[model samples]
Target: MARKAQTPDIGPFDRHSISLRVDHVRQLFQTLDPYPFTERDLDKDAEEFIVSWARELTGDGPIRIVIHLPAQEASSAEGRKLGNAVRRYFEERTRAVSLDLRECFRLGRLSLAIGASVLALCMLGAQALSQHSFPGSLQSFLTESLIILGWVANWRPMEILLYDWWPIARHRNLLRRLSVADVRIVAVSPDERSHPPH
Candidate 1:
């Protein structure tokens, strides 16, 4: 029977490590970024991979990123700066996510105000119609419709406050964790496969 492959343990209970292997350090970053290496954004695939692994490794202690590369490339100047680059990228991402979260909350607040106003107007209209003593059937229908519309008007605000912001907050927290994670570069032989250690 074949055995399932397992991820090699990276460290003790306190420190967790995320490992990545690439042929060149450039593969870790965007190809067309106009900024210097240290300020460049990480490539989409690389960022997603690192973030996914980071999420799985559990700990309150510091996390580590180990980048494995060929001995030659690993020893190059780019490798020396790889740690800083990765850290900077995550820091920027953290800030960006923070802004997105703030905007989400702002929108939620505004929507809530609008929704409340609408609900109040609906309730007032329903109350006014009740005092008119229209035909019994017509009055019931109008009152029920206004109440339903009022609640429906609040749907967006409720959704934003309860559901939409949660994922954004979680993403921001993950980016914050990654921003402060410790990064390391490891040299590997040319013959070694660019795969995480098993």
Candidate 2:
């Protein structure tokens, strides 16, 4: 993760205002950074800054999220395309949590099954070999080996079933909260000033 940028002296903020913009080129998202940002991934950096600030201001209440754009930006075919792209990015992120969660569960179940089978096989082997002159040391070694292998097989499923999903769930929850915030777009007027539409 990149170090968070220092908050600029944006003084006298209205409690309901958090602003960002996309400098669209034929409907593409552009960097909202004011200046001095490096060429590498400036768009994402600016977005992260906006989201970070939004989260910072959230003190047990909903804060505003604003996107500034020219009036025509939302009406153009290209603008619609850009909106779709943004939608896909967020949708994919949210979807990934569930997909990974399912995979974890699947892997956990598989591990448990394998562990149980290994233990059962060990028990059957020990019983069958009991009639033979099985060396006591060799029997102990075989039993211990099977126990270790069974534990290794069961470990992943236990971890996945018990603990792995919490972080993903938390992340998804954060995204969900951010998505539902009061997001507004201030229309940039002819004089290049931003204002809410009448």
Q: Count the backbone clashes (under 3 Å) in each candidate.
A: 0, 0
Highest-scoring model, lDDT: 1
lDDT for each residue of candidate 1 in 62-161, tens digit (9 for 90 to 100): 7777777788888899989888889888999999999999999999999999999999999999999889888659999999899999999999999999
lDDT by residue (tens digit), candidate 2, 1-198: 222222223344445345665544222234453432222122456447645665566443554455556768755564444434444444555577668767777887887788778767766766665556655588667766766765676677678778987877766655555544555444556565333332
TM-score, every prediction = 0.89, 0.57
RMSD of each predicted structure: 3.9, 8.4
Lowest lDDT block of 10, candidate 2: 33-42
Clashes of 1: 0
Which 10 successive residues of model 1 have the least lDDT summed? 1-10
> Which residue runs does candidate 2 get wrong by more than 4 Å?
1-19, 25-63, 70-92, 126-132, 187-198
